[model samples]
Target: MAYCAIAVIVVLMSCFFNRFRPLGKMLVIIALLLPQLSKAQKTVAPLVLNNEQLPVLPKEFYVAAVTDERDDRSAVAWLLPTTEATSITPQYKVDIKYGAQAAIKQFVNYAIPPDKALRPVIVRIKKLKLAESLLAGGRVEGKMEVALSFDLKRAYDNVHLIDYRTSSIYNRIEGQQYDVETLLRHTLEAGLIYFNTWINREADTNIKLAKGVKLIFTDYTEQPEGDTIYYSAKRPLRWEDFKAVPIGGKYEASVLPSIGYNERVEIINGIVNIHLAIKTYLPKSASWVRNGSSTNYSLNHEQRHFDIVKIIAERFKQKLMSEKLPVDNYDGYINVDYLEAFREMNIMQDQYDNETSHGTNSYAQQQWNEKIDKELGK
Candidate 1:
């Protein structure tokens, strides 16, 4: 309770020392919060980042985050027994502490590349407390606070202290209106958003999983897919997936197939483990139409475009299997090869459109379909 009270004090006076207050305020707050800790504690195992979901955040700079600072080993950031709610979608069992460490861990790991994740940098999170206030109209104002203690060589970590916070007021009903777990998840996101603005690059935590089950062009067996968006063009493209605006002249539609990839290297026991992946993205929002006259024909043409990207991604993956990059500066190493391959892919995409006259040349379109299929087969 004392730590919770300290969190409230920090939040209430956050604006007081916006410039230099964070440093001195922490010292004062910690001194006051030690007496109110609850004796009984609950523990939930730390949540682990999925191997594929994790990336080497740095080719050079590495990190391993530590989220637990509680002396009692409890993981629930803040617990409230109030069950008054209007709705509860998926009710988390009452009295059980949800794993807060993993919640913020998931938030941070997804925000950076693999190299950075492995950096010696330690992001120690402490004093994560949540509080709520009853307000007008039976509304409840929830406050989430996390004291982000880090030796971030980056200015984002300052002597002044990096305090993360987010709050919201929601309509209160009865019977645990909604899952507090869900709200807490959103709070972690908001806190990270505030933390990243000055500390690291901003990132989105709500990105969809990047695998396209039906359209894989290559077998990705050895490496992990960290931030890749993989799609297969072999199966064919449905009319529903192409939603990009058509800007090319005289063409009713355009399928902008994108092949993207990234590489990471870790010198584990002097043996460099190269983690690389290449995948295709079929941008639904950026692809659209003004005509459905030749829907089937146009779709086939677009499918070919997508297939071409898959072919390139497959080729890129193959290149990684054989190529040996200089490890002196891994961050700068793979760029040379991948960038060239990317340019070649774009060129081939454009060449197909030009030779087929945006699918108007039926003979050439048929020729391209066969050629790309043959290459893909090989």
Candidate 2:
């Protein structure tokens, strides 16, 4: 009896050990792979290009990037790394494939997948040896093997694009072979440029697509104490305020006289509540100064611009308060009034600068300052 019991115990122990052994090995393998696989799990964001460095993209077209965000439209794309880069880049270069998405969207609107965007445009690259015979003069010859494939199901109905693996691409530079980073960047820029050009030619017969502004909708929630609601009359302007970057031209100082607002439309107690506000700001990010010689004088000119914006905003507020607005179409109604007020502000601003000659005309500047003060009081 004792020998039989021992034999049964041995068999049970061996089975238990066999199960735990594989589990232990799996844990070890997972520990080893955790770091190596981290990059695969991480998401790459859209590429930020220096607008100055970018060549003029096809007139209105853009390259868009696929993101984790829920897209209501089709044809979004992501970039992936399929092979080890022989190129010396710490990171890959990619753009928002907006132009491609836009082109695809025109054709495959409802057919696109609802749960996720299209397949990633995979990029793979490797290096090649230098030519046996080199050009004696200034030319240095180099070559590279590259392949790319973008899913056209994104462009077509249930059609997969080319195979990145089988697609053979060769690029040779007459100059010296560049580092992996430069090579990758050059390839990306060139590839996107060519892709955009092709899409323009064939993608749509929708009467030639023209680039336009994309609309973004913001959501709002109720807060107890503090919320961002800018009211023009409630806020005023100040000097010694250095904000706003000067770009696009050579100027000493610029006053960004602007208006911005948000609205919260909610139902409370079976009644519709629309909370809207418009106000002006003097921000330091977009304004700039080239010289301090005329700082005080230039500041006054900028102040007038703000004052003009304030005047327009106040008038806009009053206009809204007095009118009977329809709940369903309230947004459109408000925007029409808001845009009209801004158009008037623009005309006034142009007149202010033209009459003052950007503050060169001392007489006109003083007269305008007094007029603005009187209107601000009203």
Candidate 3:
């Protein structure tokens, strides 16, 4: 019995040791792979550009005017400096009028997943009304108006009335603070929806065909004689191509914020006035990508640039139409103070880029201008 007991004990101990050894080895392997796994997880594929992403811009038929603080007057209400509305437009109000529409359009782009099916996503905005007056000291002291703006020519069967609302009153207070941040946020939301509605109206026909914005290829040659670089789009852009491409997205689709290009422009004005040649450049990592990947953010950034430029160009043309100016030649196109516009656009783009927390330098601005000077026979 004693011999048998010793045998059983030795066998059990060997089995236990064998099991623990494998577990220990597994733990070491996991420790070794943890860092590599983390790095691999961070690797993202580049965005794929397809026909669907191409932006289709409106022609001479489409025109828009945005006169901030316009002369449209309704019922007049005055508030003393001591007593002003503490609130801006209500969150629900803005959401109903414009926010919901913008949100819906964004959701449609990505297609709300099955898990999000129950959640109500904004698709389009129709009617907006002032539910209640934002009163000051229990008295009506401000004019809060919402105007529905739409591109009459482009909007189709399902017309989304993009609302332009304001929360301002003839207040005796010169600089009265009335929930300014909240007001601004709502204003921005309204602006985005209004702009996108116009873009959607213009782009709806082409959106189905567009996979992504087609990049404008550039050709650059160093001129040794002039000590300059000549640049142009590899292919010339004609007005007829507007109908062939997709133009915008849902929710502020017409414009996108940028940094590199903005910084380049700033560098020019800070030193010397210069021209600019603009085209999309592919990142090295992106050159290999053939399919769309969320990880590949560069492709998305470039697409955004293309989309914004398309919208701006359309708006520029619209402005020209209003002025009864020709939109045919390079001189006419360049006549608009595009430098100032680029700066404003850059500010918006930089803010958006900063929010993404991506480390990208804003030097596209500097190179673009130098390239343009070469085209101008400088």
Q: Which one wins on TM-score?
A: 1
Q: 1-378, model 1: which lDDT tens digit per residue?
A: 545776776666665666776566575756554432322112112223232222223332233564577553444333333344333322223211335565556555665443644323456656655444555554555555546554433324322224554445554443233355555555555554554453433111111111111111233322342222246433456666655556757777766668665544443333445555555776567666666644788878877887887787777766655654433333454566578779989899889989999899999999998998899788
Q: Candidates sorted by TM-score, descending order?
A: 1, 2, 3
Instruction: Estimate, for each residue in 194-278, the C-alpha lDDT of model 3 and write its tens digit.
Output: 5555544544233321212211212323334221212223422222212212333322112222212211221121122113333
User: Could you say which candidate leads in lDDT?
Assistant: 1
Is 1 or 2 the stronger prediction by lDDT? Answer: 1
Angstrom error of the Cα, residue 332, model 1: value is 3.0
Off by over 4 Å in 3: 1-65, 68-78, 83-143, 152-177, 180-185, 194-198, 206-378
Please give the range of 10 consecutive residues that has the lowest summed lDDT in model 2.
Answer: 206-215
Write down the RMSD of all candidates, one decimal each: 22.6, 26.4, 34.7
Q: Give all candidates' CA lDDT scores.
A: 0.53, 0.48, 0.33
Residue 76, model 1, lDDT? 38
Residue 285 lDDT in model 3?
22
Q: State the number of backbone clashes in model 2.
A: 19
Q: What TM-score does structure 2 among the candidates reach?
A: 0.37
Residue 221, model 3: lDDT of 37
